[model samples]
Target: MKMMYLRRLFTQELCPVTHTDLMGCLQHSPQQLQQLLSGGFAGAPGLESLSWLHNLAPCFPLRGDQIQVIHEPQHFYQTLMQRIRQAKKRVVLASLYLGTGQLENAFVQTLRHSLQAQSSLRLNVLLDFTRGTRGVANSKTMLLPLVREFGEQVQFSLYHTPDLRGMTKRLAPPRWNELLGLQHMKVYLFDDAVIISGANLSNDYFTNRQDRYILIEDKPLADFYAQLIERVQEFSLAVSADATEGLHRNWRILPYEGTKEQFIRLAKERVTNFVQEAYQRQLQRQELDTEADTWVFPLLEMGQIGIHHDSVVTKQLLSNCIAGSRLKLATGYFNLTQEYMDTITHKCLAQCSILMAHPNANGFQGAKGPAGGIPAAYTLIAKSFYESLVRRQQNHRVNFFEYQKPGWTYHAKGLWYYLPNARLPNLTLIGSSNFGERSVNRDLETQVCLVTDNMDLSQRLQAEADRLYDLSTTAERDIVQRQVPRWVQAVVRIFRNFF
Candidate 1:
């Protein structure tokens, strides 16, 4: 009965083309679509068999050899430094904020030297305004020296969310203000190569914090993200060193040239239009690489500014998971949006496994005050989700695991999809989203859905997923609930969306 329902759902809602028409529309053959519709595609149906997703976003084709999955934090840092040092054309970095640490200082020095060496090289950086200017000495202060040295060649923008305005903005404290919203996309671009990661430019991210990173050496893909960041900087605040201050070295901030309403409205229209036009261009392209074994679909979610391509694509992907599908999802923060949880438990028939941080492994494990209870709050959220699964008798189909390394904190967040009875994942989502409410409704997030038919890339992706899963232990609801305080549970019940 479920299979019949899924088939009907696919045909009625997802199928936009007949078999013959689909052959011309998708990179896949019509036989693959037939197999997917009939539930008989070899061992299992891979993402390549899904034609709807390809149609929903702009698809860029590239070879599997162009991609590299970096597993360790140290390697990610080293690769980033090396790429920055070698960059000759341009370097663009977008992160939540830059950390004031030795490693970060070194990173900035490397950029300075790169700029000193190549006069033609340009650098563009985008960071959240609230978080960047949080303390007396912060990310803004760290970058002002570079601006003073290089002027327009070294430009940075601080994005301020229009959500936290008026009385709330004044009353909100320093560390807590970031909970309202943030600029959370993390993209590091150097010349024609780009590294997409959830890790920030911090000492913890460079040392023991666990996260995912994917390096793609493709010019078109790099240019796409570069342009996307440029669009975001259009509405952000610019930083310039004050020449009149001279020895004082004072810096000035030039705010967006309009009211908050105007900024929000104009930024939304420009970003949404840019994405739609890119999608249309991809759809109309007649020279796409038909023989390419790998394709990338970029998903952008800026719900605060009203752009939600990522959310729409993610919901559709989850809702269309038929029987025999396997999905592995990891989020360091375990607060799944209610809609996502409902679709996984009640709508989808895929066998799903969720990996989240154990209380001991949470980044906020040993913090002070209410911030320290964050681990417990996440436990409460997970308990609620677990109860929902039990009520629907879906706990058997979906399992939970907690990642707890001895001395490390877990911050990895993404999704990996495996075809039934398959040992490897054919598709993966990697980026800065934790799938929490804040990601959905507050922050700006971006992730890419990578669909590959190349066996080598598939193997590498599966290995990355396996490594994380190997360190995780099965989560028991009662055990997790025992650690949650009553007060924490009450807090979670009241302000569930903020986390």
Candidate 2:
């Protein structure tokens, strides 16, 4: 009976609509999609086909009930606090940096209180060295108190990218050095549950910045991330607070025993071996959950260190989108790599909808100096991409939308793939990647490709996509072309990769 249903789901005859253009292809409205996916079969055939991704990464099987998608920023904050309070064994947090704000203070206090209460609880934090140590009272200073109090119970690692070294590292200013690379993965693990998001543990992320967050209550997934974090920590600097001087102490440690080249070589070897071992083990596992409707493939892209598994998987996924299928992509940054642009416009036959932040909705909209031109630079990039789409005559199948909420800044980044005639996405890529040149070739990035056959989870995914789309407006090529300044355009042309 299940095999028959699967066959029916995959057949072209079952689909009610078929066309080459976006409007004609995706006949069902978001409302209709929601209704169609609300309840039905226990499994999705479209998602099952994505099992091939396991060859690239370790695949974790999960039930639909294990996943929870948090929509609001406040709720996400509350949930993290609640999970920390309830945590018994371990709490691992990896973010770009922790903001210094009232809420962030409370967040640190919560971790402190949790450690004070639970005797066996351990805490591990990881942040980018440059970003965490930016200001006088930054992430490093904020975390020093915990280090002073809990000692070994609480530990943190500052991951400094080896790419920035010697003369370049010394000459580059505080904020500018971050352009080289960063530790950009965001994973918050509390014991057996893990919350993956693109948002940092900052005030804006906790309040108004729009981003995607998913809480998965599975022990294996949590353990996997915990191990991954530990591996990164091995290649990161340890933090220590001075007994009397408090925050005045300098935190530094060479990840490897030798030079920057040696560090990169050793770190690459370790990370590569770790991923390969996991993949081999996954291949050997014969007993997987037969009833499990969801599978997650964790992808890591440390291009600076020469690991590009995530980029490979991402490109493959984009290129494999069949005709009549639909792909909705959202990125806070509008600068996509040339390969990604070419894949979408020329290679992929799927009707694509890209959602990006408007100039006003960009997080860098009100910066003081050259940083302020970032929003405009992104607009210029978008304009060029739109022109390419038009030049290739792919505008009918590919479209763009700008996310512009009144009070919120857009920071969501991910991809959702829907099979032909399907009301909900069967697969989704969620994490810290913007799918830009930096993400592909410079930074340390990680994302999970969630392939789920469960209708309930699919409905939630569809609803999340709908909510973002609802707040967005169609991208007009003429307006985009006119919005950028001449200076911004020139800067973008010369420094396109850095964006």
Candidate 3:
């Protein structure tokens, strides 16, 4: 009940009322609140001073870092390969799955050459067990060959996030737990440089699909990400080259502690401790990095919602939406939580635009058919969500868009917020997070919240935003409503949370 009250209070309904106007009752104006949060309200009086929640929030910012945004997959892959080859001391790579394909083979061959060239170099590859163990159609095992060659030269680990699905476990087939619960984060770190992306190491992601990419060259930031991998590695299982005993031995088999909720809470605590420690370490190292002029806040939402309950990314996003004077967001998927939807329709903003993937622009559209496959189903469901927003009473206040490009799939995801009277976005997020229920309540997500006072950086980000808007087609309500079949809308309504 207390939590429920807090949610309502934060909503800030603007309709004139008697005693129900919470903000009015508290004598707090939204403008004043925005001022308090424009630069992140930390160390303030009351609830702001609490360390437990403050540590989790992306409230603090780090400065003096060179940042670059990469969108072209071919260019991204080439740059990544270059970084891998140039590594000196250590290279840490983590992805949900290092997919099987020519792309994966290239990466493997590169690692081999790097190891041969430099004997002392350290390489650590972490992956989600459920995904890493799987093979593509008519392909050999993904990681085993690499493990065989590297042996103990390279470290291989699998993050097997415990599955306490209980009765729901029966709903899925064999290996259901693997599919349902996963470590969805994607990170790439090499020495003092890091490439943060939502894209997986696959040919499709490399050649056709589009995903947000941000490169930061700062050892302090690199150390933080590397440490995150190390901490997860501590909890993860180490894979071996032996196929016989390796399968059974690589996964950590922790017994059920209590309810799934209890176990998730414990896991959240562990993750939070690591994050707090990394943040403190970065703070200490910040003094030495003199070139960092832009502020970067690492945002993490690392657990299941009902079970673990650290919606740091979601909460911070909501705060930004309510606080920012203008907002621009791009996401491949269109599904949105009620809170987000409300924020979009209600924010006291001068301008707002949302870019989403068109039905044809879906990465899996080629695999989908009229009879309906996973890709077709998801696109249909997303259209329904888009329709809902189009029909909103405040729809006129926002502009909707879908990217248009032949033979290319849209996978971009990020948010940009402009402060009042500012020409460029003062705050932005870039990484693996998508704006949807799965990202908000289910998946393990990571994003770097970049807040900058540097005018040059803001101008560059504005140019990116302009390009995104320019490449998109303005979504018309009439056109969308006519295209989607009514039956699909019903289905979307029934299973809205998954998207």
Candidate 4:
């Protein structure tokens, strides 16, 4: 009982939104909690002790293009092309893959157009070694020329863990040479906007296969990311270092590798640990709050539930207390950690609702294609994964809602837990993290956790959730009725857990 009150007190110590330092409304009266949640992210302090809250509100509310969630290939193509064409000042792009295909060719055209503009633009690209190489040839061919052509204006680098073949120790004496983990952050930070997403700098993110990208125009977010980029460059680390030295400091540069591969390796290891730890912390941060009738916790649980002192807890702790009731889940795939999946099944059986925004296909990287989007073969794999889930879990009582992507892809990563008030767990998680096995354990993903009573953002996200949940549905019966091959049926049963 006392633990609950202590948790509330700590929350009152730190504010989640507006980056203010309030834990949460700890000892505030019922009326105070009402007024507190009703307030903006960071605004007037609560009561007299919290009066300094004015300092938390910046000079502005982060703004952006307010991009409409899209699903079509043409729109995705046009958007990237436009981004390249309109860029001025500096263009910083980081993605997992930029394959060798016509899609890459078309993308090059846009980049070239930007270079030809002679706007003195600085383009910095950080690409993954795995995605850059299709196992046979180097993927760096796509951006190498720009780096050389633009000279002082344009720059590029490849991020790879060197000589990392087969399987080897990731931390044995810190070989620091073998590139095991790859940098998987898909972000486009320009002078005016910051875009953190799951889509890489490849055609698949835009075409028929299904993809999503979100643009956040908050200047502070952009500036924060930009500084991190500079830190990567200044400290020759991508291919083989720990982290960019003193990442938060501006105008600070430590020795950095001239090549991108070193930076990539270093960046991957650095983020890998971070994601693992974050998942753990988010789960256990909230203390029992029976008195106030609720608990508050960080979206990324640090590591309390982790298997080892270092092993991370990637399992999602589906909230059941009013918070998990009004849940909205958006992921590229339907598979979830065992714990989370069971939690949802239990909650639904008990009478809670769940909504999902899943891409058309579960995203199986298709065979090497001419255009590089997604081949029909890959789509088939995704289709099978969904069918198996429907057939197997019919008795779970969970309302599975699927979202459809419009002319563009919807790559927003979030889990809205609106409990009793639809705004209680109105805690929205936004970032580059994906729920898949590769994302949760292998790749380096970062996301922002925002817990707000802001009805405006919640409304927009909720409406979008509704639209998507009604769009995509591939039932198990549909697959069986279509007379899918026995071999395909067998594969679906065996691998549904993988999606």
Candidate 5:
């Protein structure tokens, strides 16, 4: 009943209220960013990247010391295994989901290997509760075995947003919707080095889903992620004695403990209030809007909604890459949004030559049913989207292809732009942000855009893009169901802004 009351206080059948109304204000996007970008960058920082989550840094840079584009899952997976094999003191894994079979076996082997080798090694894992409930429930079944196999060394929990579903359904007031839209972030940090990526342990995201990761060794970002993991650890401690919330609740696999009325109150009062504060102090001010006094043009855009709605940053990023003379190179989920297609098509006619790599099958390497290994719904969607892009580009003189390499995932997230005979290099932006709406705003995402004078990085990125643009194959958009025959394709298009 107490939990139910807390939840009631949060959501009311009322309209959403935002902290700031920035319509009249004219903010300038930062021009300096336009001049320092080179090569390409990509990342998908969800949930934790929320501008309103906890004590987030006012602004954080998404750049790394040595910018390496990893398109192979084995490269990233082996790298992580290597780290686990060498750990001396502690090993920590924070995840959203861990799928079935050998992938699952491989995950257990790596961590259990260390725990079995040494009795003193401490291993902690914090996972998401959203996917843990239904489906296969692999995460739930594996926990006891981990502890049973390694005993003192292995410890884990399926973390969840306290006021969400499952446990709340039976509670009074039934305020389970509070957990809607909650995100699952993938991170691993230990011994001064942090590995962040879009891939999860499941065969889907790593071997199945197209994904990427970066090994960061420096401060600020590393420190921030490390601290987030620490917070989860703290939550786990609370569950030991019974003060469950977020990470702690899931770690122990505890019940929702609170009532529906209790959850609603908390969602409205605590959750909404928390995000509002984050929006005002950090997101609004830190999101650079306009740019001036640089050879590169500032981003002029519309249809905005995010930290600062209708802001010019995203549009600027798009326009900057689209309005090019020689090259337009990028790699995404290959799902085309209508808005994205319109913008890219317009830019192509304006003289930008386009190229995209990433064979649709690579991300699903060694999978069982469908997207790649079998006949999955996404394959149909991918085919439809790719065909749409091809249709538009073919109508013009633009260069485009479906880059295929022996063992690569094509996970790079930045685009390349080459100007006429000018000596200037290309632009590169990296981070957990994508071309999708969820990436741009819905999910808390972070990105670093750099316009550098470095020709090597720019040239190399452009060359790689050319490799992607060279792939050309017809798609089969056949679907399993007729009603939603175009449903999946429709989703990919709508999500990317096509509608």
Candidate 6:
């Protein structure tokens, strides 16, 4: 029965509409497209009225559920650990890479304790293979140890999307796919509750580095993520590590070199199925709350030409959020693709608040260095995004700001507010989607589209945004008009896609 449904879903191409088709509409009918664009993305022909929200909002099963925004890392950890402690049925952890540190060690211990306490509880962990296998000094070294400790009670799955192999590998640069492709989602699900953030399970993400953290209690949403984990597990390799001779760490899991094409196909299918299921579920619930209408949906985008270029649910949902509304965007990096540029600038909005990382605010990179160094180059590239907006005078419509605190890098990424004059935000985006070409065209990403009617949650979100804005310095025209070095500009244009 499952296979039959899967086949039918795959054949039908479950997206309501594709990005390419939208582009075609914009190209073929400029005057009509301009009218919709002026009204904002949410006001697109099919999505303009409030009735559209009613039609799509009922899919979420929770009512007046709790949704909290955690601005501080300590608070995020406290909430995360508390939920893990309370999870009785199952716990699933997924991240791009689990960095080794005091935080990592402490988390492992907590999980170990939880498993020991509950004999029947099940735990599953999914991580990227390339990142998992990479050697790091002072790493937590828990993967193999935990497997050894819990045996069958704990399961681990590692996603491996190898680069083009054999002759193709030789033709492309070694880091080509590394920069273009990889599983980059960060999700933590504990039974009926879930935590979505761009932060990985590491010290920086838990403490110093800034990122968005959203905690919501909803069984349907949690189950949706759990199902995603299961889909990934099917494609991921069941990894096991053992004591190895002469290895520095004394443990190793042999590498995997498989059919990259087949791996990508399975991964794309997983995303497609997830979208289809969410769409179908929404259709089943017709009487969604009208007074304080709030609906939740999962947005997955995998960068495989036909699959991603056309089926970017995140972009679509973002458009819906922006329809007839202003926008407040926060991201650590500020590199906008043409698509996003069109979406933000062309839309009819009273204002736009964009919070990003200044070169000095980049925790991973330093501002003072050789002009051609990695950190310097990336800083300059970020500035290019600013330059583009300024040159076009889009800066007037945007209150460009950056979070500032010495030594702490900013890594938050998502659209926070999607309304104009409301006391609180009605819609928000949370997860690993960055505002850049890589996130748009190359990474496996996941985020939750949180639509809610709770005034308290809205107030908390507003407070967080206000705090960041307070710390931020507005990017006036003069500040953005500074001349960048010709050399830096040239290099930025060359590597624009990679950022």
Off by over 4 Å in 3: 1-65, 136-140, 164-179, 244-252, 255-265, 281-292, 305-314, 320-324, 347-350, 368-392
Error (Å) of candidate 4 at residue 493 is 12
How does each model score on lDDT?
A: 0.81, 0.81, 0.62, 0.45, 0.43, 0.62
Worst 10 residues of 2 by lDDT: 12-21
TM-score order of candidates, top first: 1, 2, 6, 3, 4, 5
Give the poorly placed runs of model 1, Cα more than 4 Å off: 1-48, 243-259, 477-481
Lowest lDDT sum, 10 consecutive residues, model 5, at 293-302
Residue pairs clashing in model 1 are none
Error of 2 at 390 (Å): 0.9
lDDT of 2 by residue, 154-238 (tens): 8788888887777888799999999989999999999999998998998999999999999999998898899888888877877
Residue 279 displacement (Å), model 5: 13
Worst 10 residues of 6 by lDDT: 245-254
Q: Candidate 4: worst 10 consecutive residues by lDDT?
A: 302-311
Evaluation by TM-score, superior candidate among 4 and 5: 4
lDDT of model number 4? 0.45
Better of 4 and 5 by lDDT: 4
**What is the model-wide C-alpha lDDT for candidate 6?**
0.62
Which digits, one per residue and each the tens of the lDDT, describe model 3 over residues 267-367? 55456666555544432332232233465667665545222222444444445444336778888776666667766555434467778877788765655
Off by over 4 Å in 4: 1-73, 116-119, 135-138, 161-181, 229-317, 320-324, 342-397, 401-413, 419-427, 450-459, 474-499
The candidate 1 region of ten consecutive residues with least summed lDDT is 243-252
lDDT of 3 at 497: 63
